[model samples]
Target: MKKALTFLGTMVLTLAIGVTIGQVSQADTPSAPGSADDPIVTKSYVDQKLAGVGSGGNTGGAPTGGSTTDASFKVVTLNPGQTLKGGEGAEFILRGGTATAIASTNGGVSDVTGADDLAQGANVELNHLLLTPRNDGRGLKVGSSTAYVLVRGSYTVQ
Candidate 1:
């Protein structure tokens, strides 16, 4: 009798858990412009993979990998002994921000040429760095002098 009772109790507990899970699943749901039935995981799950967006600023379970994360990228042509540089304190900024990187240049490093190189709409110039003092573009001070380029920044998309 005790064994039978134990079996019955275990069965009841399992049934209760199963029913709870079912209820919870039906309790709430998220939706996009449509209903939950037409779910659309329109968030970025791949970085540097290219498409309509970047990690989209949302991991969506995807983390940033490396320089070529969201999309395959080509490097700026550099001579054997050539080097590129940024201003003493030049930061990188993608027009419209990293989210818009898909339709535009996503994350950017200071030294390289404009965001997407010299492609159409490309605003950065990662090649041939000018090391003038006074922070000209994106490079160290050529020497210890004082000058300025005073140019606005831009991003590029391809």
Candidate 2:
């Protein structure tokens, strides 16, 4: 009886130790880096990746870093009657000259700085942050003179 009791106690203790060791092992295991469970990312890497987002196609003007592929904001000079169309999420800031909003059929450009939506043919406020809601022909139309615009994201000149 005593031996049986000792054996039962040992078995219980062994089972408890096994469970503890299993938990410890699991806790010590490291998750794979940059995975959804880990998600470790450097600040520079994140900035570089974000800089390239939505910056596809023609930039209309020379971009920063002297490379067409650079996604940084560039100064675009538009002549009279020229149209600067923006892609989805594109941003523009008029620095000089007069321009008008080119709204899509569904909506218009969002003037974030002015807290308003610019309808088709509405005058673009200088230095106001204009955000295109979509890629469907939302942009700026140069007025009677040259226009200097700071632009980011995808765009084209027509």
Top candidate by TM-score: 2
lDDT (0 to 1) per candidate: 0.34, 0.91
Return the TM-score for candidate 2, rounded to 2 decimals: 0.56
lDDT of 2 by residue, 12-74 (tens): 999999999999999999888988767798777899877776486445555456434445789
In the order shown, the candidates' Cα RMSDs to the true structure are 18.0, 11.5
Q: In lDDT terms, which candidate is top?
A: 2
- Across 1-158, the per-residue lDDT of candidate 1 in tens digits comes to 99999999999999999999998997685544545455444335343356534436654543556322222222333222222343333333221111111111322233333323322222332232212222333322211222222222221211
Per-candidate TM-scores read 0.19, 0.56
TM-score, candidate number 1: 0.19
Question: In candidate 1, residue 147 scores what lDDT?
Answer: 22
